[model samples]
Target chain A: MATEAQGESGGGLEFHPMDQFIVSPLFGDGGVAWYTITNATLWMALAVAAVFALLVMGTAQRQIIPTRMQSVAELAYGFIYKMVEDICGKDGVKYFPYIMTLFMFIVFSNFLGLLPMAFTPTSHIAVTAVMAFAVFIAVTVLGFVKNGAGFLGLFWVSSAPLPLRPVLALIEVISYFVRPVSHSIRLAGNMMAGHAVIKVFAGFAAIAAIAPLSVVAITAMYGLEVLVSFIQAYVFTILTCVYLKDALHPHH
Target chain B: MATDTHSSAGDGVAAASAPGMPQLDFSTFGNQIFWLVLALIAIYLVLSRMALPRIGAVLAERQGTITNDIAKAEDLNKRAKEAEAAYEQALADARTEAQRIIAETKVGIKQDLDAAIAKADAEIAAKSADAEKAIAEIRAGAMDAVRDVATDTVGEIVTAMGGKADPADLAAAVQARMKG
Candidate 1:
């Protein structure tokens, strides 16, 4: 067995599963500078292209009875449109284009990452944090700009006892600040964990004794990851809607 | 041999010295954020300007067409209902007219029959009266002739036997015998 041969040789079975997520330069062996195109850039560009093809080219005909691709594009549009409307009310619907763009990019990136040897830009904190921070800054600024000092009322707990109000307010402020952290981590963590688990299973497939089990585990994890991919995208978008709602109506 | 060692050492450095998680690396955040914003802006433009308007137009057109078709169908249905009622009313009117004509014809026929019956009755009465008059006249004439013949015969017999009879007496005797 290869395991036995590796044992006889000094080197052990060295399968670096996290190596798949390395942000190396795409062109040559050069280190990734700030501007050097990398795997993340390529996949991000592909995600953008996929979104364009689905939303723009797919619906170019604008048939009364939509074709299959058009149906998919319309379904995605209506899905996010309804989500924003339902969560943030009519006022939040104006920002639907931004939310829709965010959802399409994340979902397409997640889906493309499932392809063989594909990089998932969404799995990186660098990518997800940018989106999360953007949402955080936008909602915070909107809250202050729209509500002025009344935005601080979002932290005030009127229902609590007068003695506990300050403590509860503190907790609310902490949680409010934690929103971006949790938002960014939730998507990136779920994606990174699922992909890492699959890579680990694939590593086990080299052993003859447990190769079949490893394949089954990979299949199951892949199925779960597919669900996670869509769900994480949905969760990220809905949370953005929730924050937008808070910004729009920060009374409670 | 030196190149091989260097490559192996580089792999070793990457595996051992690198951060445990690549996500914690903040160096590439600028690039990812820059590109993400660009891509997202492009998507937003495509959606807002191109895709959403087209889809909205199609949906609105379909709704308009459906509502218009429904209204047209409803109008046609109302007209059909009015036509049906008008047909029923005309049918009833024709039936009543037919009944009135039949009744009038029957009354006219009855009046004509009554007049004809009266005329026949009058003509029968007139003809019977005429016949009775003629019979009466013939009877009287016959009676007179018989009396005359009796007188002549008697006178002739008398003459033959040299005896003359009275004509007034013969006539009165014959009339009295006929009466008895």
Candidate 2:
């Protein structure tokens, strides 16, 4: 379809795959302002609304025998709840709500982005970075607040020899700070790569000879992206739980 | 084809002239981050206040209902067991009462049988004694009558065959012959 549009305009098949990631003003063609309701804003709001519909309105009745939406909502709730408890222990379950919100937002954004013309906010490093930074900052603050100066004990390797302890501590500190970068990049890279690859395949479909092969490749990629989308969300959430565990128990 | 190439060239120039990469374009980062934080805060509030509590309540309520139902079932089972025990006790009592009645009946029947047998024996003994007394009286009377007849016959024979003799002497001879 894209190639046909280009052909109609007397253009040869030229596809700019990265153009899809552009964040433009939803209302006007002007540059995005801080208050401008961009496509990212709309999709992010939609994700929140989706979570509300499933978790709040869907479970409004709280039926003993749950409806399909309620079942989904409860399943999500239990899934995140169990993850938090298992990873962070009972004490850390107090923060289950925040973790649940993060999971729902990311997963919903990913699944919604799979729509033909939809925007995936999670594919942008800016969005994932903010979430990762928030987790990093919050856990670090909580670690100190809860454990006092002993929070540094997280970096100290008691098992190592006394001479090697300082080196191990430096390594641990660097890796600890690197968590947010890796965490953000993992999600954004997976989502961005899958979408770009699909677009490239779609562009290849312009050729009559390879059109069928392009379609098959797109189909396969789409399936993999579906799995990737959910898995990435789960990975991000579980990692958050792990960080929270570290904050709660710095001794380990 | 000419128009397609023209538009394609223009798109390529526009793409090149545009910012390096939209992701790297920091001009909009401020806007995106602001909205993202706003959106995330809104989501967190809604989940914490409205959605999560509702879900938690539902789960807690379901758990409570299950436990209550189980407790009620246990109570009913206990009552059923009690009722069964009572039924068994009543059955045992009835069996005992029936056995007592059977035993009493057997003893009463035996006592009545023994009393009847004793009364019949006494009546039979009294009747047999009266029969024996009557037979003895009849035998004594017949013996006395036969003796008197024999004495008269002997006196007549002596008077017909003898010469003149004293009545006393004849009588004596008869007596002596009879004796001999």
Candidate 3:
């Protein structure tokens, strides 16, 4: 009975036993254990490479009216321009290029994960965590440089009365610290959950008698996931704008 | 799950390919992160320098086209107004010329009537002087003829009477008769 239970526990197929990347501690056959690379890292590099190649090729053939490559380039620029204008106002025009690149990187990374055999970099907490931390650091530093020590007053929120100052400051400080954690987790969690669900459903459908229905469900979910992926990218970029706005104008 | 099958396969790969393969870690991802940042910077530079300007030029070109269209419309309207003014001026000149011709004709008719009246008055005065001269001439001739006739009649009467007396006797007789 024990053997049977053990056999059953280890039976059938389980997709993705490890995280997106499985790191090994050694370099070759026999060596001291050092470090390993994750698949998420691989996908991230792929996304970056793909983006670089696309930009290089897109600009190579510069048609006056615009070819397919030029159109793609124009679409990227125009989309980011509208986003900055809407979220950060006219003053945000200066940051248009940065925000546009960030949006495209996230979008491409998220879409790459949706493929059959591709890894999703966004599903990993560390990747999103680092990116979020960078944003936090940048905005915080900018606020200080722009407003001096008065930037600290952002927590106290000068509008608070003397009696309520300490309590409000404590809450504000907590929320400020929570920013990076939430920002990173929101993207990581959504991506991880979506991919996990798709894998599980695919596994169930693979062995089921009515597999066709499950395929349909999977197909529908994929379409929905694509939409969510775009929305997530847009949300991330807009939030970045909002945070930068706070840095630029510390009152809010 | 499926570890039993994977264990044999894993053992095969782990043993045949590489012996005693160590586990992986998060630090291996560091290099990747570095390259990613570098690539991101490169992409950013390309976008800022190349892509953005093209987009700006397209927008600027669109704006310029609109402004040019507006300027053209304004110019056309100005020209139309000038043409309208010119047409009105020409019409006014034509009317003024027609009025002047009518006025000149009226003055010409009045001048003709005044000249004819002066000519008729001179003609009537000349005809009246000629009639008066003819009347005076006839009156003188009639007087002379009547005196001559009377003298001849008296001579004839004296000769018929066979009077051989001198002219002095005749003159004395006439004077005595007149005094009586």
For TM-score, the strongest prediction is 2
- Over A74-104, each residue of candidate 3 has an lDDT whose tens digit, in order, gives 6776777887887777876787777777787
Superposed Cα RMSD, model 2:
6.7
Best by lDDT: 2
Candidate 3, residue A86: lDDT: 79
Can you write out model 1's per-residue Cα lDDT over A139-188, one digit (the tens) per residue? 99999999999999999988888999899999999999999999999999
Q: On TM-score, who's better, 2 or 3?
A: 2
What DockQ does candidate 1 have relative to the true complex?
Answer: 0.27
Scored against the native two-chain complex, candidate 3 gets a DockQ of 0.11
lDDT of 2 by residue, A32-106 (tens): 788999888999999988988989999998899899999999999999999999999999989998999899999
Among incorrect, acceptable, medium and high, the docking class of model 2 is acceptable
Runs off by more than 4 Å, candidate 2: A1-15, A160-164, B1-21, B96-180
**lDDT (tens digit, per residue) of candidate 2 on B41-108:** 98899999999999999999999999999999999999999999999999999999999999999999
Q: Pick by DockQ: which candidate is best?
A: 2
Tens digit per residue, CA lDDT, model 1, B82-146: 99999999999999999999999999999999999999999999999999999999998998898
Q: What does the lDDT read for residue B56 in candidate 3?
A: 67
Q: How well does chain A score by TM in each candidate?
A: 0.95, 0.95, 0.83
The predicted structure with the larger lDDT, 2 or 3, is: 2
